[model samples]
Target: MTSGLDARIRLSRGPVELEVALTAEAGEIIGILGPNGGGKTTTILALAGVLPLEDGHVAVAGGEWEHAGARRLAPEQRSVGLMLADPLLFPHLTALDNVAYGPRSRGSHRTTARERARTELASVGLTEHLGSRPRQLSSGQAARVALARALATDPDLLLLDEPLAALDPETRARTRSDLAARLAPYEGVTVLVTHDPLDALTLADRLVFIEDGRVTQVGTPTEVLREPRTPYVATVVGLNLYAAQSDSSGTLTLVGGARLVTADSTAGSVWATVSPHSVVLHRERPEGSARNAWPMRVSDVTLQGQSARVSLTGPLDLIAEVTLASVASLTVHVGTDLWASVKATEVFTYPR
Candidate 1:
C-alpha cells in the first residue's frame, strides 16, 4: 500500500444515481458538501463498504479496497473509522470503556486498550470525563468521546458524516475548533461530509461539491469562494447567483428579462454573481454613481445574527444583507417598496 487515496465511486439507490471521483493524499482532509439527498452520504457509504459500488473502485494508500464486482472489503475488514451526527455512544458504558472497546475488540490487551483510550480521551480534552457515562455528558462532550473512539483503532482513513450537525450553534462552533485541533495531529486521511460552509471552509484542505449525483465543482476554499460554479454552491457561499448572457461590452441580460452591467469583458453565456453585502437599499430613487439601480419591493426580512437579509423582488429577485442599524433606519419590512443599487464593479461574471 502506498501513502494516499484514490477512489472512483458509482452506485444507484432508488431514483438517485451516484457517480463521483474522489482523491486525497495521506493526512489530507477532503470536505464533501452538497444538498440533502444529493448522494453525499451515498459516496461515503460506498467508501466505508456499507454500500457496494455498482462500478468504479476504492483505493487508499496504494491498497485496492474495492474494485466493483472483482473485489469487496467488508466494513469491519477494512481499516476505516466512521463518526456520524449522532454520537451513538453506549448508554450503559462509561466514556473510557466506550472508547476502549474499539482497541479491545481489535485484539489489544485490556490494560493496553484502557491506556490507549485514556490517551485518546485526554487528547480530546475529556480526561476528567473518562468515567462519565453518555447520559451524563453534554452533547459536545459526547461528540468528543465518539471522535476519540473512532480514532482509538488507528485507522488509516477517517470518515466523518456531519459530525457536528447535532450540536447547537455555540457548541458547534467551539466543538469545531476542538475537532480541528484534534485532527491536526492525526496522520491519516480524513473525509468530512458536511452541509455547513464554516466546517467545510475551516477544516478541509480541499472541497468537492456533489449535486444530483454529479460533482459540480472542486477547489481549495479560497478558489471556491472566489468562483462558485453552481447555484447551490453560490447559496452555500452566501452569494446571489444568476445565469445570464453577456454582450461584448460587458452588459448581461438575465433569463428573467433583467439586465446587469459588469466590469468583466467575458462575452456569450456567463454566470453573474453579486454579494448580498454589496447591495444598497434606499427609500426613493436617489442613487448616484452606481450603474445599476431598480425599484424593488421587500418580500421578506429575516434577521440573522447582527445583520438582516432582505429579499427584494423587482426586475431581479435578490437578497440584500444589511446591518440591524440599517434595517432600523430603512424600517425594512414585508411589502415595503425600496430601490436597490449596486456598483458595476461589484458584479462579477465568469464563463458558464
Candidate 2:
C-alpha cells in the first residue's frame, strides 16, 4: 500500500490551466515555489480540498482524498492541517484555547483537546504564552501559536502557505529557524507553498517550481541551485543564465550571436550560468587572461548591503555584483561605460 502523498493536481481557472504532479514520502517537506498567479497556492488549496479538482487525484497515506468526477473529501473531512500568512486567531480566546480549537472541532473531548494543545504549544516554544491572547502576543509569538494550532490535531498532512511571510525580516529569520526545528520531528508529510528561495532551499527535501500554471522544474535544493531550467528560476537562484549551443571545444553560442567560453566541453544544446560575483568590471578594457570580456554600459545600479548589483547592457546583458569599495573606486553608475570580464572557469554548463 502507498503510505505517502501521491497527487496529480489539475484545475483550470480563467486562462490558467494548472496540471502538476506532486509526490513525497512520509515526513518529507515539499516546497512549492513560483511567481504570483503561477498556481502555487492553487495547488495547496486543492491538496487541502478547498478547491475541487477538474481532473487528477489527491491521495495521501494510501487513501484517496480526491478523484475527479469520482470521489472527493470535503476540507473538514480530510486529516489535513492548513496554516496561512495570517494567524487569524480569535480575539477572545487565549493561546491555549486557540490551539485547542482544532482538536475540539474534530470532536475530541474538551479536557483531552486542551491537554493535547498544551503539548503542541510547548513543542513550539509557546508554553509560557499559553494564557496570552492574540493581541497580547508579539508577531513572532503569534506565528508560533498559529503553527501550534495547525499541528494540534496530529494531521496526516500539513499545508503551510507563506507561513512566515507576515513577519519582519528579523522576526522572519528567527521564526524560520523555529519552524525548521518544529518540523524536524513531524512524521506527517508537509507541503510548503512559498515564494522565498531561502525557505525552499533550507526547509524542503525537494522543490517543485510551478510557473504559468505548469511545473517547470523539480529537484533537490542543490540540484536546482546548480542548474535552473527557466529564466524565472535563474532569477530566483540569482544567476545570469543563458540558453546556448556549445561546441565540443567549450565555445558557447548564445541565441543573440554573442559567445562565452566555458571550462566545460559539453557539446550541443546546454544551459550556461555565471554568478554575478564572478563578473569583474573595469573602467578600461581589461588586460588579462579572461576569455570573456566585453565593453558594456551600466544600465542600473542597486545597493544591497555591502555590495551593489550593476546591470550592464551590451552584446549580452548581464548583472555584476561587486563590493561597495570596488563600486566607489570604479565610479560605477548608470550610463557609465565599463569593461566586464568573466573567467572561462566561472561559466558553468549543463544539459538543456
Candidate 3:
C-alpha cells in the first residue's frame, strides 16, 4: 500500500540557511524543479535522512522519524529508497548482482534476495540484460537496472535525484518513458528532483518552484503555468507580468493610469499581462477588431536569437515580439512612432 509524508525542515551551514514545509501522498510524484544551487537536492537529502535537520520533523507511513524536542531515528531505520544521479554499479558485479546487493546487506538470505532482485529487474524490463556488467550494458539499460536496484528495498518513500541527467537526449527520453510506466505501479510517496521542465510537466502530479532556499510557488501543472506569484515564477511560467491597480466596470489602469479593459472580473489591485506576440504595431492608431491601442515610440529593438523583441515608450511601456521578417518589413527603428494594439481578451487579468 502507498503512504503519506509530512515534513518541516531547517538546514544550515556557515552563513546559509533553509526552512521549508512540505506534504505529499503515496502514488503521487511531487516534482521539485529549479535552477542550480536552489537547495532542492538538499531538501531531498534531508527528507531521505542523509542530511541532518537543525530543527523540525519528518513523518512517513504513520511512522515518525523526528520531532522538535526529543525523538529521532537514524537513517537506516527509515524504509526509504534513494537513488542518486550516478548508478554507481560495482564494476566487478553483474547487473543482477548489483541489484541484489542492497537486500542482501539488509539480512535477506542470498537466495531470497536474488529472487527479489530478479522480480524487480523483470518489472523494469532489465531481466534480459541481467548478466551484462555495468560497462557492458547501454546507458539506458544501466539506468533501468539502477532504478530496479532502488526498488528492490520495497521502500515507503522514493527519492530520485536527476536520475536521467547522465544519459544522451534520446536515451534520456526513452528511459524517462520507462520510468513513468514503472512508477505507475508503485503505491508509495515519491519525490523527483530535476531541472528539466519537460520531465516535471510530464511525470509529476504537482510542481514546486523553489529558489534561494525557499518555495516560491507550488501547484498543478496548469495552475503553475497560469498564475505565478513571483518574478522568478513568472519567468518560469514564460510570462512577462506587472503589478497594477484597477477600478470597477471591467476597466483597468496601468502604472500611469493608462486605461484598458479586462476579461477577468476583479477590482482594486490587479496584475496585467500581455504576451509579446499578442501585440500588433502600426504606424498610427487604426480602428477596428483590437480593443486596446496605445500611442508608442520605439525605444529599443533587440533580436532574441531568431525572433526579435522591441521595447516601446507609450501610454504604458510595452514589449512586442516579432519575427525577423516582420522587423524588416515594418521598417522598425529606434524613435519611430507606432501604435501598439492588444485585445482585451488576450490581456490576462488576475488579482495581485
Candidate 4:
C-alpha cells in the first residue's frame, strides 16, 4: 500500500515514557485503543508535531516531518487537522468564520476562505447554521461544525482525539454517524483515538491496541474481536480471559494454580478465553461430561441489557452471562454457592 503515515517515536516526560510505531495507507482510518495513560494521545500529538519525539521519525504523505531527533516542521507547518474531545471553537466567532479560520490562516483571501467554509459546512449538513455561534448550537451541531472546520483546511492527515466524547449518548450516536459520512470521501489518513468501542468498530478500517507505552495488537475489528491477545482487549470484547501454563497432557495450570483440562494443549505460557455465554452454573455437581468444573461463589451480579453478568470467585475467577429467565429459575444471587462448568472445546487456548 502507498504510505500515507509512517512513524516510530519515543518520548519521555519525567516518569512517563512512550514508544510506538504506526503506519497507514492513504484513505485508511486507524483506531487507537488503549487503557488510560497508555500513550494513545501521546502518539497523536507526536504525529501532529505538537509533541517532540526524543528519538525516531515521522513521515506523512511521503514528506518528512521529524527525523533523527530533529523536527522539520511545527504543528502548523505540517498539513494536519486536529480535533479534540472539546470542540475548542473560538467562542467569539460565528460558525462560518470558525470554519473559515483554517483556510484564512493558510493564505486564502477573505471571500475564498468563506466560500470554502460554506462548502465544508454544507458537506457536514451545517449549511443552515453557518451564522450560529458556538453557544447557540446544540452539542451535536457544534461537533459537526468542528468537523467542518477541520476538513476545510484540506489536510493530508486528520487526528481525532475522542471527538465524540463530550456528547450525550443519543447525540454521540447521531454525531458519530455524521462524522463517518464526512470521513468516507476524504482521501487522507485518519487516526482516531477513542475509548468507545462502538466508534472504533464502526468507523475504523483497522484497530491498534496499546498498553504500558507499547503496542500489543493490531488488526481489523473483526479479527481483534474474535481473538483478543491482552486482558484489556478481552474485557473490552466481553470475554473471560486467563493466563496459564499448558502441558502436553492437555492440562492447563492458571496463574493462581487453578487447573483446567482443554481439548487442545501445548507447552509454555498461553492465554485461554471463554465466552460468558458458554459458562454453565449449577446449584450442585452437574451430571455431565464437561471437562472443567469448579465450585464457585457468586461475588456480584449485574444486569447488562437483557442478560445478567454473574461474577464468580473460586478456583478460578470467571464471568458468566445468563438470561433473566435463567436467573429467576436458578435463584442466582450474591454469596450463593454454585458449580460452574465449561466443555473442554469451549476453552480456546493460544500461545502468549
lDDT of 3 by residue, 1-352 (tens): 1158888889885444768777888788899987777788889888888788889989988888878567777788888887767988888999899999889978899999899999999988987888989999988888888889988988888999999999999999999999999999998888999877778888999988778788878999888778777766665655657677777766887767788877766888887777888888887687988888989999999997788889888778788898888788888989988898988788887888
Error of 4 at 352 (Å): 2.4
lDDT tens readout by residue for model 4, 1-352: 2369888989975555888999999999999999998899889988888888889999988888888655569888999998888999999999999999999999999999999999999998988999999999999999898889888988989999999999999999999999999999999999999999999999999999989889999999998888799889998888998899999987899998999888886678888889999999998988888989999999999998889999999999999999998888889999999999999989888888
Q: How would you order the candidates by TM-score, starting with the best?
A: 2, 1, 4, 3
Candidate 2's residue-wise lDDT over 12-101, tens digit each?
A: 877679999999999999999999889988898899998999999999988999999999999999999888999999899999999999
Clashes of each: 1, 0, 0, 0
Candidate No. with top TM-score: 2
C-alpha lDDT of residue 207 in model 1? 98
Q: Which stretches of candidate 3 lie over 4 Å from their true place?
A: 249-261, 275-288, 291-341
C-alpha RMSD for every candidate: 1.4, 1.0, 4.1, 2.1
Alpha-carbon runs more than 4 Å astray in model 1: none
lDDT of 1: 0.94
Shift of residue 260 alpha carbon in model 2, Å: 0.4
What is the C-alpha RMSD, rounded to one decimal, of candidate 4? 2.1
**Candidate 1: clashing pairs of residues:** 2-61
